[model samples]
Target: MAGSSHYIMPRAEFDDAPKLLIVISPYYKDIADNLLAGAKAEIEAAGGTHEVIEVPGALEIPTAIGIAERMSNFDGYVALGCVIRGETTHYETVCNDSSRAIQLLGLQGLCIGNGILTVETQKQAEVRADVNDQNKGGGAAAAALHLIALARKWSVARKGVGFTNDILMAGKTDGSSTA
Candidate 1:
């Protein structure tokens, strides 16, 4: 696996410049900076604009994105952070919970690129965060951009996924019951 290569998808396209929010946990300053750089470069390459918000730790990244999704106009989000394994179970908790929250947000229709790195050592984090190397941050950004493109491609004007007001009031409006 050392000399293996993988397929990389081309940058995503947008009808209008998509706005993205980059939520980063700068606990590991150097790693976080590298991740941010990669994410920003990828977003700009895709003709998208971005705003960055810094949180205290990896666990907070998802919360910040959730808040932005509800109160802002961002089309997507990039989550950046490094969680190097430590002696305590805190590492596992942080990794699992943060990832779960991000996935939940994505399931709720928020386009999110999860770049939080959970590694055994700082060296691993560095390699993955490096813009010239693995560039996991860039990969995350690409994922979000792809989702955004898909959402836009299938976007339609509709009431939602359930019963409409018309259906709910059908018989009530005339004070009658079908049965």
Candidate 2:
């Protein structure tokens, strides 16, 4: 798959495989299942283990991941869902808010892959979710894995600037020695 035309980056490899959390919304049950299949297969291929959790709908997916990031120790997250347009404006709200939330969480140093599909028709969603087609789910999983690898690479960052006077005693706000 080495082609300059595609310009795809090489897959990230890890010595210590990371654990991942998949937060999916099953509002569109069949579509969600297909997405999950692709995502799980991709995570497995990357030598990573994952836990899947279903949110009520697309709007809840990012919220669930945010909770997991605070309360759990998952190395990364994959977000999957399908938002098919309807007659109401609710579709836009769900699509925009969920995506914005996911992006915000990623900015907060959480490795996340956003796979929520917002489409005008079920046909569009199906094509994107299909494993043998666009395989957006698998693409999302791959993105998360790559981010995790990058996180691991930078986990050793040290920005400390201190000396003897900067050392603080236990429970002390000021940099003062108890002795």
Candidate 3:
């Protein structure tokens, strides 16, 4: 049942080419490599350029993206990592906190694709990270590209910051009543 289901991903197109920052936590070197390969392929397929950065662990991925958003000019971000369940509750903490932070950042209007894999074992993570199989990294990139396209589509040019010309012409700039 794993590979039986399919999702209809939105077509990732943009009027202007987008630049994406891929932040990865490479605790598992092989899995990270596969995820990065898939993400790169997807971004390139959509005519977008990307830069990859490595963080220490899954918990750091969101922080890296947040810093990049404030300091750099990337149009979007892709977060990639794998957290396998262990004997202790550290796995739960990492998975929950990392995912929550990513979600909060997304809510703040950042075009972010979350590719972090939380699984019971390394085998499960391998299957999901494999480009030939689930290709979650590619899926995440596509998701980010879609968001960027949407933002571009709905974006409107700002004429000015203050009130409109009509409001100014009315001579009612302040809340005080003339009467």
Candidate 4:
């Protein structure tokens, strides 16, 4: 006789333990507002405090994030904006530069969430900005939380802390266990 094996999933328990900063562009007011609201709700649900900062436009998100990262007060950041393709190549430049800067911030161990929506038309942007559904804002906050969780985990692991029960127990006695 054999019994089925059961497995447990590890849950990220970062509730009420982190702070987040959200930067929004005023270029597309309506869409930006929706994104901000969604991101704020998600951050609060995750047990985190959040603050919103308005930038001139999507092009300024990276700079704002950079300043936030340098401050090191918040654990993570979420950038919200809407960039719709127009008659020129301005869209490409904004999208690429903002993305690159965010990535760079992440590489430097800063948890940055990108909520900027790049679309071909206003309609497409509207669909994603809908607060009822398809909310990119929530997605960005989730991303920030995820990155912070991973960074914390990695930091602990680097210090020779294992996720195993035995190691955790030993660490507890040594006051070196984190979780």
Candidate 5:
């Protein structure tokens, strides 16, 4: 029996379709391909657009996103990768550090969905990445879309006191204007 039931969120509609960047670590190319398929499907279904870039490994995913944030025009980011637990403690370091970095970036007010799978075995990753199964890649893309919607909802171009031309001119002369 499956450990869980299928669950999917309602489809989202957007006024201003988001332009997204998908940063994937092609450490496992096959898994990455599956992930990309799912992510692309979700992005297209939502009427959003995305571009994919690959880094060497999971460790580089966040750094790539950070760089893209400063250098690219994407409204949101989807981080996709898989890190199968290994015999060495390196797995933990990679898992923890990458996840932490992604979270930190999100807290910095970037829209990001982290889809790095830190699993005990390849089988686990396959199950999660399967399009008919967990479909974590699509979920991550959906997550980014939701966050982008929220960001658009609460976006602040500017927030402060306002003044008309007359008020500004009068204030410049008298240094006080109730207008």
Candidate 6:
């Protein structure tokens, strides 16, 4: 079944002060390569350093992310994978399980980006894998950065900073303000 898209949050400006780890599944080598390239470009544009790790398939992405979180070196993570549906129930299992795992990671404040493409066919996967355009990898990197930014803001707010005028001014200067 095609998933609903209305749940996507509006994009937010990302803070560039944190290191990132990107884990990609190499099952579909070409698509994974494009995703890696897209993620690298976006991270560089945001002035952040990123390290890439490759796993065997989408099933291994969440475990890799969990391990990275425990290491405590990265401020965020981006997961890239391509799981094209075939003529078997295996497609549903992979898609659902991977999506749920990523959501669980985010709920636990892991700052994980989901760039996994669950498509019905190889052609659709290719269409979504365009590194320079319609790249889910770019979207995933943006999501990870957005989560990190929000987490940092929440921490500062909890410290009695109170989201003051000075903080607002700083955000404006850095183009972090929405309006």
Measured by TM-score, the strongest candidate is 1
lDDT of the candidates, in the order given: 0.93, 0.91, 0.91, 0.83, 0.90, 0.84
Model 4, residue 72: C-alpha shift (Å)? 3.8
Off by over 4 Å in 1: 156-179
Candidate 5 residue runs with Cα over 4 Å from true position: 1-3, 156-179
lDDT of 5 by residue, 38-127 (tens): 899999999999999999999999999999999989999999999998889999999999999999999999999888989999999998
Between prediction 4 and prediction 6, which has the larger lDDT? 6
lDDT-best of 1 and 2: 1
Question: Ten residues in a row with the worst lDDT in model 3?
Answer: 153-162
- Candidate 1 residue-wise lDDT, 2-103, digit = tens: 899999988898879999999999999999999999999999999999999999999999999989988989999999999999999999999999999999
Over the stretch 13-126, how does candidate 6's per-residue lDDT look in tens digits? Answer: 554467899999989999888888888777777777899999988988998999999976898999999999889999999999989998998999888889999999888888
lDDT of 3 at 65: 95
Taking the tens digit of each residue's C-alpha lDDT, what string does model 2 give over 1-179?
33434445566788988899999998989889999999999999889999999989999998999999999999999999999999999999999999999999999999999999999999999998999987889989999999999898776454355444345455787766677
Worst 10 residues of 6 by lDDT: 4-13
Cα TM-score per model? 0.87, 0.85, 0.86, 0.79, 0.85, 0.80
Q: Local error of candidate 2 at 160, Å? A: 8.2
Tens-digit per-residue lDDT, 140-162, candidate 3: 89999998987776664444556
lDDT measured at residue 58 in model 2 versus the true structure, 0 to 100:
90
